[model samples]
Target: MKQQQVKLISLVMVAVFAISLVLAACAVPATAPSAPAGGEAASTDVAAPEAAAPAADSNFKPVWYAPAPHPYFEEVRKGVEAFEAETGIKVEKQIGPDWNQDSQNQRMEALAAQGFNAFSVYPADAVGTNGLYEQLTPNGIHIINFGTSTAQPTTASFAVATDVKAAAMRAAEELIAAMGGKGNIINVLEVLEDPNTALRKQGIDEVVAKYPDVTIIQEVADIKSVEEAVQKVGDALSANIDKVDGIIATGYTPSVAIAQVLSEYKEKGGDRTIHAVGIDTDEMVMQAIKDGVMDGTIVQNPYGHGYLSMLLLQYLSEGYTPKADAYFVDAGFAFATQENLETYNNDILAVTEQIKSELLDKYLEK
Candidate 1:
């Protein structure tokens, strides 16, 4: 009986020892030095663990590719140019003939063969683009999506673009406000092939549904080009000219198309006061805002999309790695009305700077 008692006490002692060790281990983290060594001042602010600074990779060749030429892409090209000037890293820039998945695949493969190690691409097709990334990544090629992202489970390292759904929702809110909270809207969208269009469509529809007074009179999709966007938007407006009180376009092509059609409508003495909100500050779209032809456009940081993607690619090539949190980097956007048309660009630039400052902690692990 005495041996059994001793054994029970020994087991309790072992349990207590184990618990004490765990407590001690936990307490070590909680106990921090109150003062720095050698009488140095201690920091009051706790900063995130700093990632190692990336080494410059002069030999890495990166490409900034677009599926087609548009004003939005032109702005993105300016950012690419800025990156080239800033980094002294020459980018092999290429523009595809059209926004087609097969074209993107062929062009990217050709570039890859020519020794481009990094690419900042606007996926020609959101779902289909992943196949290209899947092929490239295993071969040591790093791909970044500039304007839009592929569908989830992407092989691309990062996507530098505006939050399309947020931008679209904002556009809806702006449109509804411009129409005095009640209107029949003509919703113009770009290609249905890109999944961003669906997110954008959902964003717009969700926002409009909140206000019972707002109704989408006509919604058009699958506008593949500026020509198609213009013709289709014009037709939609004509068909609902008497009933349409507002037009909202969340895609670049459709936005520019809306600006042109509305400007013509205003010039042709169309008596209907159609308030329009569109995406991207194409020179024509901005001019429309300035000329009072359209209400406003959403100015996304296309420059940031190009510049940051290249910057990230540079880091990636230099052996810097992305944190798990670093998936979609929101370049940001602003409503470019006549009020801020000239200076709105400054706001977009600020967003880029803010993201850059946070990239080490918020994005890249190393």
Candidate 2:
């Protein structure tokens, strides 16, 4: 009986041990390590971090270009810089060598290749620049004419320049007034290649015609540089000094030249009071006004020209279309004489403010 009891106990113990081994095998994973409590395995299920988005203003690539380096362009450039400072928008600014259409074409094409989509340009040739604009506009590029305009039937979105004809007329009126409405005038013009020169010439001529006594005794044009203008204007003055009573310069280079020449002519004690009027408020010209060597100058809003054109280009770039009737925007103009020299800028700024307030509702289709 005792042997039977011992054997039964031993058999029961062996069965229990076998059952424990089987249960342990079923509870744990046999071949692989288990994942965490609520997620996929760290070693194989990691997700990549998302990339950072690009800056909003970085996509805009605008360029402000002048056909050549001039003091007027330099002042306009100040306005461009002011815009950048105000808006925090960047621009690629350039001034080409000589005022030529071909060079403008080449440089613009190169810039286009580098991904500049907007331009504030002084059109090199009034008629020929349209061909370039045609090419650019088709490819989603925008253009605005500053300082002077391309010819009508143009592809340029807008022109933010002085009314060249009107300004010229004003300059002529000032010159005629100083001449006492009776004198032989010397019409000094800059590059005939520029269409504005022709318009200016016609304005001067029409004004002269109104006063029959004021005849244009000598006309000297194709004055490309200050040096050339000095020589040409000096020659005109020397040749017709006896009869030349009033001098009018309608372009920047010529205006500056006239200021210098007239100042020197006065310093040298030239007896004749050859009254003069010019366009622009060049430092020399302004000084001449102060010295009473010049009668007056037509002060165009070059700062407004620079600031407004850039603002327009920015708007037009962002899906705004020009109104059908919107073309030439006379930025504004004023006659700056010595008497009103200090106050001219305030008047011009008023014009700028008025135009800016109207731009959205009046000029754009949105």
The candidate scoring highest on TM-score is 1
lDDT of 2 by residue, 1-366 (tens): 699999999999998998988886675541133321111112122211122212325557899999886656765776676666666788899999888899999999899999999999998888889999999988889999998888888889998899988989989988898888898999999998777788899999999999988899999999877899989988988999788899999987888889898899999999998999988766788889889999888887777788788878888877788998788888988887878866666677678678877787788877
Clashing pairs in 1: none
Q: Please state the error at residue 298 of candidate 1 in Å.
A: 0.7
RMSD of each: 24.7, 27.9
- The residue pairs found clashing in candidate 2 are none
What's the distance in Å from true for residue 142, model 2? 1.3
Per-prediction TM-score? 0.80, 0.79
Across 1-366, the per-residue lDDT of candidate 1 in tens digits comes to 699999999999999999998996676421143321110111112121123334558669899999986556766776777677666678999989898889999999999999899999999888898998999899999999988888889989999989999999999999999999998999998888677888999999999999999999899989877999999999999899989999999887898899899999989999999999988656677778888889988877767787788888988887778898679999998887878755666676778778877876788866
Model 1: number of clashes?
0
